[model samples]
Target chain A: MIKPELLVTPTSVENVEEVIDAGADAVMIGEERYGLRLAGEFDRTAVHEAVKLAHERGVKVYVAMNALFHNDTLPELPDYLAFLDKIGADAVVFGDPAVLMNAKQYAPKVELHWNTETTATNWYTANYWGRKGSARAVLARELNMDSVIEIKENAEVAIEVQVHGMTCMFQSKRTLVGNYMEFQGKDLGVEGRSKDRTLVLHDPERDVKYPIWEDWNGTHIMSPKDMCIIDELDELIDAEIDSFKIDGVLKDGAYIRDMTGLYRQAIDQYAAKPEEYIEEKEAWRDRALALQPDNRELDTGFFFKETVY
Target chain B: MRTEVKETAAADKRVITKKPELLAPAGNLEKLKIAVHYGADAVFIGGRDFGLRSNADNFSIQEMEEAVEFADRYGAEIYVTTNIFAHNENMEGLDVYLREIEAAGVRGIIVADPMIIETCKRVAPTLEVHLSTQQSLSNWQAVQFWKDEGLDRVVLAREVGMNEMLEMKRNVDIEIETFIHGAMCISYSGRCTLSNHMTARDSNRGGCCQSCRWDYFLYEDREDANAESGNALFAEEDAPFAMSPKDLNLVQSIPKLVDAGIDSLKVEGRMKSIHYVATVVSVYRKVIDAYCADPDNFTIDPEWLKELEKCANRPTAPAFFENTPGYEEQMFRNHKQKTPFDFSGLVLDYDADTGMVTLQQRNHFRPGDTVEFFGPEIERFSMTVGTIWDDEGNEIDAARHPLQVVTFKTDQPVYVHNMMRKEL
Candidate 1:
C-alpha cells in the first residue's frame, strides 16, 4: 500500500483532515512557522484532539519538537517528554540527542522521529538515531534523491523526507536575531505586538531602514515551495523509504488537496501498472508542477544524490 | 500636589544609558536621503547582487557611491548587505561587490556566509563585517565563533528573549546589533524551509512569497477530501496562531533598549514608502535625541506618541518586555482600511494672530472631513465646510485641483513644516 505522509505545521490543521482524506497516511504537526512560541508548552490539547480525530479516521499523528534545544532549557526536557507521553502523542520528532534520549527515557511508548534539524545527511547519523531507538527520521532538507535512496537503503529505522516547504537558509537553529531581540528585553515568544520588538532586515544589502513589524521572529529565511514527487513515488518507494512526507504546517487546504490528490493518483497508477506508470509519472509531474507556489523554479531537492554545489 | 509631581518625576527615570546606533533600511537613493534627513545614524542596503532581497530597488554602483556620499555628509554610516546564502555560482560576484562597496566609503558589510566573510576580509580588509541574523547566532559559542571569523558586529537572532541576550552578552565581546522594530519571521532566525519546499524560490537566496499568510487547517480523517473536494479547510483548536504580528515598535522603550547594551537599534522596512521612512526615522531620532539631551528631563511626548500612530501600523504592544501572560498583544486581525487620511500638502505659511493656515493641496479635500496636521506633533481637529476661499478669496465647496493653495482659519497655530492630511 502506498502510504503518504504530509508534514504539517500545527497552524495548517485546517487542511489536515483534507490531506488525510486525500489518501495521506499520516500528518506531522510542528510549531508555528514564524518561530513565535504561541503556547507555553506544545499544545498537547491540540495534539490529543488531532490524534483522536485522526485515529477515528485511521491516520496517525506525529508531533514535531524539531527546534534546537537550548542548554539552559535541557533540564525541562524530561517533564516536557513526560507531558508529551501523557498526552498520548503517537510519535515525537526532535533534533537534539539529549532531547531524543530524554524522550526515549521518559516516554518509552511514544515513538520518536529524528528531525532534519540534526542534519542527518548520511546513513551514519540515521543509524546512530536508529540505534538510539528512533522509530523514524525526517532527513535533512538538503539531501538529494540519491542520498535519500542511500540513507533508506542503509538506515535501520524508518526514513522521512521533506517532500515540500521552504528550506532554511542557515545550517541549523542558530539565530542572531532571536538572541538579539531577547537581549533587548523583548521575549521573542510572546504572542502580541510589543513596544519592545525585533526587526527583520529585508534587503540586507541596502542600508537597513525599513521597519517590518510582522514576522518579528526575523524575516522568514525562505518561502513555501510545493514538493511534487508524484512521478518519483515509485523510485522513492523502491529505495525502501518508510514515509513520503509533505512539509508545511501553515499552508492552505487547497495546497493540501491538490498535492495529496496528485500523489495518491501517482501511487495508485504505479501499483496498477508498474511499466505503464512512466507516462502516468510524467502526468503526475505536470499535476505537481501545476501546484507550484507562485511560478517558482523547481528542483528535485538533491533527491538523486548529495548536492555538489 | 508637589508630592504627586515628585512621584510622577521619579517614575520617569531613564530605562537605559547606552546611546544605541539607529540603523535604517535604504531600498534606493531617495529612501537613503529620507533616512539620513530624519535621524538614522547608519543605513543598510542591498547591492545589485548577492543580497537576499532581489526584488527591492537595490542600488546600482553609481547610486551606492552617491548614497555613501549622502550618508557621510550627514555623518551616518552605510552598511552594504552581502548576506545571501551563496552557492558556488553566486561566489563569483563577491570579490568585486566587496571591493566596490568598500571603495565607496561604506562603513560595513552585513553578511551571513563564512566564505563571503573570508572573501570580504581578503578583498576589503578595512570594511567592518557584521554577522547577519541569517547566521542564527543564538549562543555565546556561536557569537564567539563569528567573532573569531573576524565579524566586527553581530545582529542577534529574533527568537532569543532579553534574558538570553544578556547571558550571551556577558559571554561575548563582539558588538551586538539587535532589531528594535520591524517585521518578524515565522521561522527561527533563518532556518525555515516552508517557502523553498513549496515554491522553488529559496528565501535564503531572497525570493520569499510569504506562504505563512495563507490559511491552514488540521484534518481529522483523510476522507474530508471525499466529503467536499472543494471545501476542505480544518483547524484544530490549539493549532499555532495564524498571521505574523505587525512589526516591533520600541519608540517608547528607547531607554530600555539602550540599557540592553545593544550597539545598534535596527529598523525593518525596505519596500515601505518614503513617508514611512521619514516618519519612523524622525520619531526615533527625536526620541533618541530627547533621551541623550537630558536623561533627567526626558519624557516621550504624548503628542509624539500619537503622531507615531498616524503611520501605517497595527495595534501596538511591547513584545515580551513585561512578560505578561496572554498573546493578545501579538495577534492582529488585519488593517481595517487603508489609512483614512491621504497626505494632502504642507503648510506654506501660517499666521497665528489671524488663525489662518495656508497650504497647497496635493489632493482635493472636501469640507467637514477631519484634517490631521503632522509636524513636531500630530494634531487632528475637525473642519466645518465653511466657505473656502482660494488664494484670491473665491468661494468654493472644495479645493478642486492639485497645487491649489487654499486658506482656512483655525484656532491652533500651524507651523510651516506641518504636513496636512484629509480623511478618505
Candidate 2:
C-alpha cells in the first residue's frame, strides 16, 4: 500500500522503452543541471516526446524549469510557461517567485514545484511557496532529518527531497562561478576548453587540495558526493514525507534498474515481514553505498542534529 | 578555419592598466607574518569578538599590535573586519571594539550594516570603511548607493560575474574588491538562513551550523499511507554537506584579473591555518610578480601548482570568470583524497658538521615512508628515511612517541627552519 515516486532525470532516459520497463509512476525531465546557462529553452519536442511516451505507458512526466531567473529576464517567462502548458507537461519545477507568478497566469493547469534553490529553510517558506502556487516544495539540501520531519509536519504542499545523484556544494541557483565566468568572457554552457576553469581551496592542516569545477553553465560547481537514502527507508517513511526524488541525469539504464529494483524489493520486503526487513535494508544499504563515488564520507545530516559549520 | 569564426577574428583588443591590490586573510599573527612575507599588499583579519568566524583563533590586542607592526614593516595595509550583523545585544560592545580597532592602527574596517557605517563615520572617521559583500553589491545602482553613503570600497557580491563587474566598474567610481579565492557561500552574498531556520544559529549574523552537508532522501510515498494506491513511496538519497563549492582559486588567471582593473583580489578563509596563508600567498605572489615583471613571459611554475595540490582540494574550476552555470557544473564528483603522508615529526635542532637532523616525532613513521621537507623558496625534497636515532641517541628502527626527539642523517644538509613530514 506504500506509494513510491521516482524523480528520474530526463538525461537518465535511454528511450521510451526503458522508462516503461522501469515502471515508475512519474518522471521528471528537464536539463541535466538546472540554471540560466544550462536551462536553455525547455525542449518542447522532448517534453512532448517524453509525455507521449510516458502517457502511452500510463506514467506522468514533469518538466523541470527550476532555475532562479533575474528580474531582467522576467519578460521571457510567459512564453516558456505557455510552452509547458501547450506541451501538456505534467508539472514544472520553479525557484523564482517571478516565474511562479508568471506561471500562474500562463500555465495554470500545470503542477508547480518549488525548486530547492529557493532555499526554503523552514516550514514558513515551504508553506508560503505551497500557498503561493507550488504543489510540491523541494526541500533545501541543508535540511537535517528532524528539519525534514518538521517541514513535512508543517508544510501544506507535498514535500519532495533529492534522493540521489551528485549533491551540490553551493546553494541552489545563487552562485559566483557564473559571475566569474561572465567576467572571463567564456560561455559556461558550451563544452570546450572552458572546462579547465578550476577553483581550489588550500587545506594547510591536512596539506591537501580541494578542487571545484564549473558546470557546463559556469554558475556553480557540482557536489562530489551522491545522495543515497536506501538504508533509512523506515525512518524516512515514518516521517510522513510525500515524495522521493532521485537525481541522475548522466547515469546509465543499469543505475535506474538496479536502484529501482532494490527499492521495490525493500518496500515489498518491509511490508511483507516488518521484522525480517532489517536484513533487506542492510543489503540495500550495501548496494546503494557500493554505487556511490569512491572514498566519499556519508552522514545522517540534519536528521540527527544540526551539523557543525 | 570555420566560416563564421574567420570573419570576426580581427576584433580590436583593448589594453588595460591599473592593476588591482592583493588582499589576503590572516587567521592569526603567524599567518599575518606569512602573508606579508609571501607578498600580500594588504591583509584582512578578524578579532576575537565582532567578527564572523567565532571559531578562528582571532587576533588579541597584543597580536593586533604585532600584526600592525608587521604590516608597517612590510609597507602593507591591514584591514580589520567588524562586519558581523549586529543584534541588539551585540551592539553593547561595539563602541569599545571600534575604539580598540582604531587604536590598533588598522587601515580600514569592513562593515555591512548601515548603522555601523554611520557609527564608524561619526566616531572613527580616520578608519576608512570598505563595505562587506554581505551588503550585496551587484550593480552600478548598488555601487552608487553605497558610494553615496560615504563608503570608500565595496566588496561586490559573489553572484556577480566578470562581465557585470566590468560594466559596474565602468559605471561606478568607488573601489571594487571581489573574492578571488577561498570558501564560497552557498547563499547569495552572505544572506543565508539555512542555519538559522534548521537550527537557532543565524548564518546572516555569521554563526552558521552548516546544515546543508547532510545526506537526504527522496521519498515517494507517505510512511503512514495505505499501500494499495502504489502512489505513495519513500526513497532515500545521501545529500552533500553545505551545498557550497570548494573555495575559489584564480592563480592561473592572474593576468586576466590584472587586465580587468579590479581594485583588489580578495582571498577568503580568515579562519584558515598559517600554512594555508603561506602556501596561497607565496604562490599568488610568485604568479603576480611574474606577471608584473613580464606579462608575456608570465607562466605559473609547475612546482607552485604541485605545492597547491599538496593542500586539500577537489577538482578546481574558474568560478564565474566566464559564465554562470548551475549546481551541476560546480559540483565535484570526487572528494579530495587525503594525502598518504602524515606530519610525523619536526626537526628541533640540526648539527651541520655531524650531518644529523634532530626532530621531534609527532606521529609514527616507518623507515620506508617517503618524507617531504617544507622550506622557504626551496623545492620540496622526496627522501626516504635511511637511519634513525632515538632522543637518547640510541639506534632505533622507528620513533613513535609524541615529542620524541629523533635524529637521522640526510643525503644533503637540512636546516632546523625546515620541517620533515612523511606519508603513511
lDDT (0 to 1) per candidate: 0.62, 0.63
Instruction: Put down candidate 2 lDDT per residue, B89-135, tens digits, no spaces.
Output: 35566777777888888899998755577778877888999999875
Report the lDDT of model 2 for residue B349. 74
- Candidate 1 residue A7 Cα shift, in angstroms, is 19
TM-score of chain A of each: 0.76, 0.79
Q: Output the worst ten-in-a-row residue range by lDDT, candidate 2 chain B.
A: B1-10
Error of 1 at A126 (Å): 19
- Model 1 lDDT tens row, B101-173: 8898888899876667778888999999998887555555556656765689999766555666666667767
Considering the two chains of model 2, state its CAPRI-style docking category: incorrect
For candidate 2, the TM-score is: 0.55
- The C-alpha local distance difference test score for the whole of candidate 1 amounts to 0.62
Fnat of the models, one by one? 0.05, 0.05
lDDT of 1 by residue, A244-286 (tens): 6665433356876667766666766666777777866667677
Per-residue lDDT for B262 in model 2? 74
Candidate 2: Cα lDDT at A286? 82
Q: Which candidate wins on TM-score?
A: 1
